[model samples]
Target: MGWLAAGADHEVRLDAGRVVARNRQGRVLRSVPKAVRETEAYLELRQLHEWLVRHETACREQVEQWLVRSLPVPTALIVEVWADEAWRAPLRDLVVMPVDDAGRWDTDRAGLLRDADVDKGLGVVDLDGETGRLTSTQIVLPHPVRLPDLTDLREFATDLGVKQGTRQLFREVWTRPDDADARRRELTRYAAAHYRELRHLQARATAAGYRVQGGTATVKIWEDGVPVVASVWIGEGDPAWETETGPLGFTDPAGGPVRPDDVGPVAWSEGMRMAAALHAGRVIAEDEESA
Candidate 1:
């Protein structure tokens, strides 16, 4: 059952990617049906994504720079990062769906969320006794990442840039003289747990001839002139988790990693690749008869 479920999930995700790619191609085809080709569609999608990122950031920079001082630094940063993770987690399970469904899987607008066979990954919930409706709450399969809000001292110093206050607060909060040994142990444990995931990603990337920097904690992998994807293993106190540049979110009140499983598939088989596979004129609906 697990095997079938996993494979089905992969196929579903792949199908969803194909659908997105097809829609993208269709847009170009509509505009210039006589001239648009597969190559053009692929190039257009790639360029469009690049343009979107640039425009989004460009428009936000003025606001971000203006609010830099008054903004709730740590909390705002953590929430932004957490939101990113939340968005990606769903697609991770979806990737396995496509592999499971083979050539008969279908997907709707909500992407993998709409797949009927998604119950396992969705995690079972008890039906309400009165209404007979299943619980709407869904727990993340991999432990959710948590982010913590900064204390008043940390926040003031961070936002105000009071040099002495910031230095003193850091010493008192992050590096208390009395608990140095205990803090080391906690930091060590966090690093150890993140090592396995980092190593797996590094190995795959290295075998693909990519140069990897940083270890199991936070890594930056680059394929020379092609592209770079940085997989940062965020921790509760990691400074990197406190900025809009990251893709994580922290719970209100106390910020922390919302979900560790937010890291979706390390593979990039979505969008164009999925569409290319389907464009060979193959149908992708799920088939249960074979099993």
Candidate 2:
């Protein structure tokens, strides 16, 4: 048998009654007998695997945070990180925008990164659905925060045959319908069992940048300098077990009810996103009986 996988910059192989590690030059670095469960070589290999897993997770988490917050990332910073294989793996094939010297996203210069070239700069598929090279000194990784813009970007990327390895956080969000009266009615009676406990849901909502109050989750957005607040009732339940959620409610800064039609698109989308997320954690009827 030959090496089946590569890990921590070394080739790993299961040999005759042992595990073997080899360097890039095919030189045997270490071997661990199958009977030995805690040899130095085995421990080192385990540590390497653990480190690699943590590195991968850290890279993805950092990138995801940037996307969720719609933060502007410098092109130079990305290019610098691309030099490392661990960081590059998560960033490959993501949509990136070139930033002009003025520190603004130049949509005209945006493209899907095919490769990060140290010498020639980035190889990309531009908005025109054509392959091109972007040699700009600075670029911005725009978060897919704008729903309409994200849709157009996906369509453009599709035309160029660009496929991303990681999830696009700023993708378009789906809502049930635009009918205010119908949506209000649905929300009034909405109740779903969450897979997570009430406390867990509340904590998650708070960590996601929402306000947690009296066992309810609230998100506030400003429209034209007026505060638009949306809140969902998260019922109290055992902290360690799944719980059910209560109805969702929306109100203005004055504590007055705001109709769905009166809510701006941004606020509406964010409010629904919170509701849908909590709803997704619902404990199914079939699972309840099993438990």
Top candidate when judged by lDDT against the true structure:
2
Model 1 CA lDDT for position 62? 28
| Candidate 2: 10-residue stretch with minimal lDDT | 32-41
How do the residues 215-271 of candidate 2 rate in per-residue lDDT, one tens digit apiece? 678887654346788788776656676666777777987789987767765566567
Model 1 C-alpha lDDT per residue in residues 91-193, reported as the tens digit of each score: 2221111111122211111111111222322211111111111112221111001102224434543564434311122321221123445423422221212
Q: Itemize residue pairs with steric clashes in candidate 2.
A: 193-282, 193-283, 195-281
lDDT of each: 0.25, 0.66
Cα displacement (angstroms), candidate 2, residue 155, comes to 3.0
Top candidate, metric TM-score? 2
Model 2: runs farther than 4 Å from truth?
Answer: 1-34, 159-161, 169-233, 239-242, 246-271, 283-291
